[model samples]
Target: MDPAPARLAVAVKAQARALGFDACGITDASPPGSAPHFANWLAAGHHGEMAYLARNAARRVDPRKVLPGLRSVVCLAVSYPGDHDNPPPPPALRGVVARYARFTDYHDVLAARLRDLTAFLNGLGGAEARSLWYVDTGPVLERDLAQRAGLGFIGKHTNLLGRTLGNWCLLAEILTTVALAPDAPERNRCGTCARCLDACPTRAFVAPFVLDARRCISYLTIEHKGPIPLELRPALGTRIFGCDDCLAACPWNRFARAGRLMREHTRADLAAPDLIELLRLDAAAFKVRFAGTPMARAKRRGLLRNVGVALGNLGDPAALPALRQVAQDPDPLIGEHVRWAIERIEAP
Candidate 1:
């Protein structure tokens, strides 16, 4: 690599920081060799109903297929740290949403910043600027690319753990035709740390550096579209959107700080939503409430379904009315979950 290219890479990093990314790094766009592991994971039915993972297996392993002539992957991390854990539910509330869903959807926020970065890179040296940006909407092995870019290591929980920002940050990638100098992969910093592994209520981690998505609370609530596995519901606790137990348990988060650009994105109403209110939400109401938030991805039916599970976990008789009301929901999945909740709440 020419020194000029290296210098340009350094300048790009600075520009990325100025553009509001918490951290940035460049890596050569290459197929990550995690396909065997992914294949095994899928074969074991660990991905549950997230069939998309299996559908794009080849494209996900290689960024080049998604964007031909991809020479570099500019990975960015944006912190969305909260001042506190999920908020306490109201006296009669039964569900609690995870903190990440509390604010504006990170996909929009981070994609905008990535567009700016790509524009900046294009202006430099008059490159054609052919590039694609992804905020979890593309077939890309983002965490692996982040690690290759020296941005972070894939922690035991399988999240990209930035040395400075921990796992509370969102990842976005810009695959470009520009051939910026690449950074060496970072060393794993999770030495002797098993807190994340031990904190998993579902024992999702089959072993170090591996996660069985089927048993992960985040996957169960947010990714799985059908009825949640009976055995995993009890381990979900009150997490209705996603789970952060493993991320929170990581020791490196002690040094993590909320990114200045995303300070306003901290936990808001969704820190812990009232389960009763969530269950009562119709499609229109759910859309209005979660218009700009990540929770909207779950859609009205999906979210209400999770709320039913949370209500079941609460096992409070006071939640009977809310559960029964949703039991007649138009969506079969929501109604099924509501019935499940009714059984759990009425038991004993």
Candidate 2:
């Protein structure tokens, strides 16, 4: 066992922490152990409209497919203050953005830091070293790789959870050509626990570890751009962006730590946005408000569509006029959801 590679792994982790990552680990870039399960999950049509996941299926199972000569994966986690990240939705008709989305787009926030870390890794491994970093969009089974790297274990909710960061952390990875010592993997500790499965309002979990994204509030609101199915609209409550009930229910959060990197990027305004205000956001206004946030990726129509469902679930009569006004929105998606809101408020 050469000491040089082990020393390099330690330095890389220390550098990651200095860059504001809360947890970091190193793992060999072998094909993820869950590749077959993932293929079966995709085949089961549980991914909903996220076709990109299916298209990148092959690359996702193997880091070598993504980067030739990839020898190591640097797994990093950044915890956003889980304790207060999700304040109860305000008394007013305000909508809740998921804890992760309340910050400036995490991808943008983490990318800058990842670039610096990659550069540092390159320098540590000498001139011929090369690396590529991605927050969550990279074609790799990051959650499984994170566990193999000893950063965390995959819980029943299918989220990576660590004693220190819980399931409330965001993951990033850097695939590098440099060889490094692999850390011991963490084994699952969710024995006799099903809180996350029970916490889901829409029963998104088909079984202990299988999630059906079609019924997931986060996916229905954030990823699926078309009108949400009628059956799931009421379950959305006021969550206009993403859902965190499953993550919040995890017991491991007893050790949840506050993260430094995301604190700097938090958008206080997104904590509890006025539902009506959000519903009325035209394209220009939407862009101005959510320019650098995760909601920007959802776009104006998608967000307001969510806003309409939220207002409907809130069942407040006061929101009717606004819902009615937006029922004729130029974007049919917004109009459809807004019309649903109007009917819901009008229902006996």
Candidate 3:
């Protein structure tokens, strides 16, 4: 028979599955193994302009720093469908969006379920129990925590992937004072695989597991606010939002399957957005169109900045007129990229 705490852990995982989480595991709240590597990565100043990562460096590597009396972390995953296969190329002027962002913001989709699970844990532990949950909002090193909970292993590209879940999954976690049985930690299964590194457009991977965010297309198109580097602009290709080339190259994806949680939230429009159409989005239109999607993270100017880069990379003369219209954008950031696009299109 399972001990009382262990029985509660089993119930928690069952409740997680019932709540539409595709996978769940539990692990004691000790600092994860990735802590040392994370510190080194940050110290090397590889996180780029994302100052937030450096700000919360301590809390991210150690869960106890964020939640007192933390006993166990309930790690959960909701897998996205096989979105990275070599699908037919989008028609001309259509831009690429990262697979996961094609759905309504995953943070919102998973937050509700995480709350309910935390409530259930607190209920099972009676009035004295305390629980906290996060769906990508917290400072925790989510992938490392998930790996420690046996949910998946960190791949060579530094993204989490599972033997079954593949790389197309979003993660969530609950921290609770209630003790739960810990699952066996998952070990690296990516022995000898470096395909993900080879697939990167910007050569962001400095080595097997190290990523230089400054050169990553995803960071440039999304998190970066200033003008993208001139040399790297051509490598942006048609990816207007984030890049999935690395994730798509994983061999384990052959076993990947879509989960139910985010299926209903998928937006087909994001699969292949029209670059010219996106270039014309005014601030209000941008807000309305991407109101509930992760694309809003880039803001209107940032997205338009990316749209300009994509148009330039596509080298399609059809985009020159639209590029010229935005050449004098008041944002200066957008204007600079639009001028660059116009020049690229009109170049000999």
Q: Write the per-residue lDDT of candidate 1 for residues 1-348, one digit (tens) a residue.
A: 478778879988999999889989999977887778778888988887888889998898888999998889988888876545434566566566666677778777787788888788877747566877888888998999999998898898888988788778888888888889999898788889899999999999999878888888888888878888888888887778988788888888887877876666654677767888888888789899888888988888878878888888888888898688778877899999889989998887
Q: Candidates sorted by TM-score, descending order? A: 2, 3, 1
**Would you list the C-alpha lDDT of every candidate in the order shown?**
0.83, 0.90, 0.90
TM-score of each: 0.94, 0.98, 0.97
Tell me how far the alpha carbon of residue 8 in candidate 3 is from the true structure, in angstroms, after superposition. Answer: 0.6
Model 1, position 84, has a per-residue lDDT of 51
lDDT tens string, model 3, 1-348?
559888999999999999999999999989987888998899998899999999999899899988999999999999986654325346799888888888899999998888899999999988989988998888999899899899999999999999889999999899899989899999999888889999998999988899999999889989988999999999988888999899989999988877887888888888889888998899999999999899999999999989988898888998888888889989999999998888888889
Clash totals for all candidate models: 0, 0, 0
The residue-by-residue lDDT of candidate 2 on 146-202, one tens digit each, is: 999999999999999998888889999999999888999999999999999999999
Best by TM-score: 2
Q: Which residue pairs collide, candidate 3? A: none
Error of 1 at 4 (Å): 2.3
